[model samples]
Target: MSHNVLITGGSGYLGGDLLARMGAANLPPYRKLYASVRTAEQADGVRQYGAEPLFFNLKDESEIRTTVIDREITVVFYLIDAVQYEPPLFFIQALSEVKKATGRTVHFLHTTGAKLFSSHADAPTDRPLLDTDPQLYEIQKSQNPKLNVAREGVRTNCAVVEQAEKYGVRGYVFVPCIVYGKSKGFGEPVSTLRQIYMIVRAAKTLGRVYRVDSARPEWPVCHIADNTAAYIELLRKILTDENPSHGKNGYYLASSGSIAWDDLYDAIAAALVKRGVIADGSVTLASEKNVEDMGTALGVPKEMVPVQLGGKCTLSARRAREELGWKPAYPAEHILEAADGEVEWVLEHLRD
Candidate 1:
């Protein structure tokens, strides 16, 4: 069946990269491409990439249904921040309806973060957690994150899978780790880089870089291009009806490998010191008061400071490699090598 695809968050870092690369992806034949947009300028922005801009209230179930059913969008790539269940449920149900009406398969790829499978969310940190593990869904279902927001995110991941299964739609949980490097899109091409940004913000306030965790914890990392490539590969599989794994086993982590958080902190610190953003390049352990000050700088609660900047997330990438034949062009330590450029770009674009 010819498939029409809709990509939401088309102006975001990941979404914009997807649109930017779509022209060169050499993807399998599909009917049409649509990008969810909010303004005339954004609509024009997506049009540059050969996408029909779709304007609809994602929160309104009826509007979402109308938009999807009318456009006959058989595939959706949801890249927006979705810690709640309602929006994704709306899309899944709408896609299921499309499947029923036309007797064609529909797919939903929900973009979630690596944090949902991290220590912050109470995911196991004792070993490398493979995305292809048969028990991954159950593990996600059992997570009781200490942070209320993270807990919601974990639940949302489970809800997407369960709801998609109930509605007979293919669901994929696309996980992007600590993705770095510059974006290649027409819109705002900067990643939020929340963790790195927090460190910089806190350092500026405290005059030095501070370590949120004493024992260096590791987290998965990915380059922007490699991350976008993984998404494209999965889309290729779907378009070709390869059935690249869906439902509970559809978790795809787009990461080269894992890196120590301390290594990242040190690299950024060196760059910041060279630019005089921080007085000292040396990384120091965060005292209680330091944590509080950092929280104030970040405008988050003190308890959430570590959750934002530190903690181990050993969620490994296996499914993307084994199933989609995806490989990262950048290695695990490439983020460290690119830290100088990353700091320069981030400093230029970061706003208070």
Candidate 2:
């Protein structure tokens, strides 16, 4: 079977991992693998991994549809956040139209974070959400977050699946947690974990870090390399496996562990203290005043602290393991080990 893969956000951490892994001959052979990048510099980034870089502005839905249709690209891995929803909606709509005009199944895997049934604030627990679990998957949108853009991402995946059922456009959704790792190809920071940047900055500015809610909110997390492997495994199966291209079979989770963002902050603070930058090796939590004053110095706004370090959100990868034989090599028990590498990278790049 001939396959041509097109990955959006190829210059990004996850996509760069895919590109580098492909370059390393990790995934099955494809006729061509093109990485869609916006800038010339971004294009150069993917070129190192031997991907044919395609420069196309994704905001223009017509352009995106044209490129997909023109190239006859069989598979697409969309890593961009649906913070901008219209382009993605339009892109999927065009694929649906293509299926209507000519019967061709284009497999699309979209990345949406595991904030779907989250901000389930009033009730917090140690139980991790499983994709096989109906409760979480059943609730698509939530009224919890006033500005719930992530909910819209889930809706987008739903719409794409509906189109697949109606017009035969194959679609899948991948929900990943806070991904940690420096990219193998470009060494770019995983932008999803803004907490890493904030914590490091807090340590630098105040010689310590702050934690709220006692630093014990379990949150879903994954290493960059492991998450990338899950993506590739799913991509490989979508093409070769007998899997249908809609609904839960099309959805996956890419998390191996959970740790409170507060705990992660503690590690960062301890690292700084051990380096003699901070006076003590402990986390401090003053009033919101501390965050407000340090916000100016550290570029972290005070009001955003609570939202960034909110309630616990855990996920289970059981279905991915049972179905695709995927397991996160770096489980929650070992997140600190990965954090050691991450802290070293953050200190060298972010705090420097």
Candidate 3:
């Protein structure tokens, strides 16, 4: 018998891409694929990918109870917003509901990010992050509130894992870096890359060239396609009961390659220049006067300016590779190339 898979946030970017991939792979053909969305319009869009759309607000208790009970969903891909709801409350409630309804072993895939492991204090300049490293875990416990939330997320994830083992459900958690690639709907905002592109364009328009410094820290990036591939592989293992050790309720960092931020900036600039969006490469970082400006320009906090400017965000994906047999098709540079293609396509199609 085929299992039913329910993907929360299915109408969103990552969910839509995952649905598209599942359709293409045709692996473990789910008896039913249910996607949760907030609006009828979003549900309509999700149907384009051949998924049955379920409109439900994640915060509503009745909706949650109704959906989980009604669907009898055996496998759930919880890819909802990380920053929106309070982690402890949101997760506890959702997990409780799912656990109550599905008495059988349910597979829960919780999505997280590498930033959850990052140090808020003047970012690390030394080496790439590792999953088993005690130091990384220690740093995660340090001063940052966001990291603290991440710690709770780990706890919540582990709780589900333990519950799965005790109650015969299977649960796994995924930690990914900046996920980028092509998709049907607008994915997470590409604010940082777009800012870099704009700065390059401005410099080129003035006929001045500025070179990006290579000494800046490297940011670990993964193509959305490759990230989704890892997810699919993990899901397949769960469905077949092939290797319970795969993902195994532990944290796995998903990164394709680590490229210095300055190098990324230069690449975006180069792409802009190639498209005649700018004449030269003289670009600079945006002034940090307002919080929104910082978020809009860099996709991070204003306080993190120094750390980001210091540029040392690098992570290792050896765990993902060895355990999950996952490999990113595009490296960091190539992913940027794909992103540039996305931008070019946007400009070409949207422009007059």
Candidate 4:
């Protein structure tokens, strides 16, 4: 049976690009493509891409149920909140009902961050954690983070898998890392890559870029195109009934490789200095006052400054390549090369 798909967060950086590229992806046959939008303007914006606009409050369980069941949306790409489990649970249950009524295999893909699998969440950082590891679900469940966001994210990811399994709905945990590059979408043209953007914003406010971690920790990075391609490839696999791994076995990390946060900081700092956004390109460890000031700039607590700006996430991207035949066009270090352009783009879009 042909699948009817619904993709959420159409107005977001990743979702808008996904929707913009969906029409040209040349995927296996599907019945229809729908994009969720919050406003009439966004609804009109998505129509240009041939996606029917789906209007509903994502937080309202009844609305989610009605929207998914009535439309028979077999595939859901949830690009919205990663820390919230309620909406995904609702979507999974709704998809299960749709499966019961039509006997069609339904899929729910949740877009979570690589941070949830990193040091902040107490995930193992001594070795590379492959996305396809058999014990990843257990690893995720074992994570006990003091950081509120990491704790919530870990709980949400596990809950999504557990709920999907209980309801017989195929679920995937899609992890996006420090994705950078120009966003090729009608909405939210600037990338919401907090790690990179935080450096620029905090620098502008503090008059310099500060490193929260004394040790140069490495994290995964991906280009915007490569990140979107991973999403499309997974969808392609699902539409063709290839039955790609789901539930606990379906962790897909969309990173080309890993880069040191120090390297990223230096690259972006040089770019800022060239633009005269900061006084110097020298990167320094954040003093207590600097972290507090940075926190004030980021509107997050001082403790969360490091969590948001710097951390070690050794989550490797093997499943997408091995399972979906996905190949990233850009390398991980490409973000460093693109730092100047990325800074300009982000600066142009920074409202505050």
Taking the tens digit of each residue's C-alpha lDDT, what string does model 3 give over 159-194? 544555554455565776766655544333232333
Candidate 2 residue-wise lDDT, 1-352, digit = tens: 5566788887776777777886553566667778888888888888888778897878887788887777767677888764455665656666666555556566777777765535533222455557666544344532234444544555665665565556455777787777777777563664534556656666677667777554466677788788888887787776674463345456677877677766777677777776776787777664677767656655546655554545567566666777778877887656666666766777767643
Stronger candidate by TM-score (1 vs 3): 1
TM-score of 1: 0.98
Q: Could you give me the TM-score of model 4 versus the true structure? A: 0.99
Which candidate comes out best when scored by lDDT?
4
In order, the Cα lDDT scores of the candidates are 0.90, 0.67, 0.58, 0.92
Worst 10 contiguous positions by lDDT, candidate 2: 116-125
Candidate 1 has its poorest 10 consecutive residues by lDDT at 186-195
State every prediction's TM-score relative to the real structure: 0.98, 0.87, 0.75, 0.99
Q: Say which prediction, candidate 2 or candidate 3, comes out ahead on TM-score.
A: 2
- Per TM-score, the best of the predicted structures is 4
Give the range of the ten consecutive residues with the poorest summed lDDT in model 4: 189-198
lDDT of 1 by residue, 52-110 (tens): 99999878899999999998899999998758778999999999999999988999999
lDDT of 1 at 9: 89
Candidate 3: what lDDT? 0.58
- In candidate 3, list every pair of residues with a backbone clash: 204-279, 204-280, 210-281, 217-311, 217-312
